[model samples]
Target: MNWIYLIMILLATVAGGMIPMLVRNLRPNLPIYMLAFTGAFLFGVTILHLLPEVYHELGHEAGIYVVLGFFVQVALQGLSHGMEHGHTHLPAAEGHHHHVAVFPLLFGLSLHAFMEGIPLGFNYSDASALPSLMLGVMAHKVPEALTLITVMMHAHQPKAKLWRILIIFACVTPVSAILAAQLGQHFELVTKSLAYMVALVVGAFLHISTTIFYESGTKHHELSRKKVVAITFGLLLAFLTLIFE
Candidate 1:
């Protein structure tokens, strides 16, 4: 079942990267809508599901780790140029160019994916929690992968190179999950450590989700009606998933 989940994740990642390449004239507003929906869903999952579980397992120390994770993501953005949060640093107009270093960008995105996988692979809380976590990760990954491919395309990376990077990026999380699961079986202290890691990820989620909200708006920080509707739908879906879970 875990293998199945991993394969699903990998396929979703690759498919996301393929989308922008397949469709030349993707609607300008599409990514913004995606960002709003996934942001709200991820935020809801972290607050309603992950935080309570981590705090229950690790107590106040978990809060400190959450803060650390938040800052860790802040630092990671320097390397990733905010790719994980749907940022494509494309130039504004025909005469301008923005240079992106591919290696650092891939490294940062891989690290973020790896961290997210740890709690899921280790079964941080229980079997039931996996569904919610998996759903959130999948929702987030599509826009993220789209951003990655878009950035690489703008940078004039070769098609083969782009595919290679996308494959590597897609594998990172599944590999991390498998590795974490193996480690948990061997180490007695894995449970507590897993709780702390989950706390860290919860913090990362909070940062990414809120950042989406912040960036999804106009100059006045007001959301457009369509985006607001998308966000509401996402929240409602999250709530329903929790109820059923």
Candidate 2:
């Protein structure tokens, strides 16, 4: 296993989590646009690279795991209130202390993070797909980390406690990557296991990317010109990366 993937992912996770702290005064709409771009890029990568790779590696049986992963993500998003897609709805006033249950939210997000790590760790040698997959995962992590921090702040968690929680959340992916590497070593048919895991993560990506695009519009669900441009740019980037990869 190449240790560099672990380091890169860990750094991306930590940087993403810390973004909210650094950009507390950023315009809210900016992050939404960023999320839209990331979502589009991820969606493009899934359709272009991941889906084909999984089907090629594992045959048609991999579709079942993809469907299962999609529903699993649906269930997780329910618990997380759609945080994965930048839906961090909070009360207007920070002074109003609502009893926000943290455990369920953390559990859902952590599970999602762990699942994401498996494919990257297990398939690190695939030069054609790994770059795009890594980029998609890293891009998605930023908005997710930002949303998670926003929610925790809204819940009035202490700064120290919030940092601790964020660190743990950030670590989950790398830890899971290491675990997946270990599991791969144990499996006699490691390629099949990796293919199935990639399919599962691809399903989760499909759910998330679609949700982000669907929600990224006006009340009437009309996309703005700027948003269209951003989405186009994202897709183009993904295509170019795939071509060059």
Candidate 3:
């Protein structure tokens, strides 16, 4: 648990996140493609990395609450139902666009991101599990960061304001890592808490993956055989990654 490795992990997260922004200049279709790839990557991480780790740490009885993770996410989405759809008035503001109310969505994402740092903190090279957790967080952060960006942009917040929000979102991973590191002696409690957080993350990823695939403006009616193969291959790859990992 050398402190330097934690710094390295944090740096890697920053690098992983920035890759998308570098390709930010690409065509609209390219981002969509990247989004699809990122989605597949997240599905891989959630199913492969998070779920397995948690299941191993906490058996069936405690794990039943895992499905509660899905319900929790659905509840979040349901509460903010208007934002996902189209424009609707915020309850507090009464006439503003619904995205104004999207801070809760951002809050959920941030909380999840903060929870992710825990594993990265405790996960030293000695533990076989750390890498997958790190990779999943890294893979998922791209879209999460971009979503944070677009959500802020859609809200018409200033560039500075958006950056501030992104900065706060970015800091959570490292903060969680530090927190885990500080409490290293209490591994059991850490494992239990992380297990629940991972379950929550799996739910969040499941929702995002399905939403991106089905709800994207792309038309399935005209989806060609090749596209179908690509998406199927993409999903299959994700499942296999989970199984093997």
Candidate 4:
């Protein structure tokens, strides 16, 4: 396993999760724009990098898994309450609080993180796609971690427990990557299905990204100017990665 991927993901998660707790006076709506940027980047990366490679390697069969992965994410949101796509209510702003099930939220996000780590563990047909995948995951994780911590704060969880939950959430992907590498080594068949795994993950990415865009927009599904700019910048960055790579 490349330690760099683990380090990068961990740093991004810790920073994102910590920011909400450390800075008491954050702009309540800031996560919306960040989600917009990350959502657009993930959308672009899925189309530009992941979808094509999966189709090229797995052919039409990849389509089924893609659909499955999309619905799978839909199911996950039932458990996560859309936290994976920045569905969070900041405690600082809301006058009242509701009971948020901490376990279900963590389980859902951890599972999503684990699936995202699969492609990182093995070399697929188009090795170039790996970097873009890593970047997409890292970029998205920031907002995800932020969303999780924000929700926990809204639930009025203890600070100590919050830190522990954040650390555990941060490690899920790296641990999954390490386990995937080991499984592939012991069982050759694990590698043969890399394309399917990639396709499924791409599906999950598609679902999350699109949901972020849909939910982040105005009630009429129109984007504010600031959100438009952030999204444009994200897509532009994703495009640059393709050209430069």
Using TM-score as the measure, name the better of candidate 3 and candidate 4.
4
- What overall lDDT goes with each candidate model? 0.82, 0.79, 0.55, 0.85
lDDT of 4 by residue, 1-245 (tens): 78897889988998999989999998866888999999999899899988998898888999999999999999988887788898643224445775777898889889999998887887656656777878888999999999889788988899999999999999998888887887888888887776688789889999999888868634566678888898999999889778635
For candidate 4, give the lDDT: 0.85
CA-RMSD of model 2: 2.3
After superposition on all CA atoms, what RMSD does each candidate show versus the true structure? 2.0, 2.3, 5.4, 2.3
Q: Write model 3 residue lDDT over 122-180, tens digit each, in one string.
A: 44322544655565556556545655565555566776676576667677887878777
Q: What TM-score does candidate 4 get on C-alpha atoms?
A: 0.93
Q: Candidate order by lDDT, highest to lowest?
A: 4, 1, 2, 3
Q: Could you tell me the lDDT of residue 234 within candidate 3?
A: 58
Model 2 spans > 4 angstroms off: 89-95, 124-126, 189-191, 216-221
What is the lDDT, from 0 to 100, of the residue 61 in candidate 3?
Answer: 42
Better of 2 and 4 by lDDT: 4
Error of 4 at 17 (Å): 0.3
TM-score of candidate 2 versus the correct structure, residues matched by position = 0.90
lDDT by residue for model 2 (19-101), tens: 77777687867867888899999999888888888887778998998998898899888677778887643335546775677
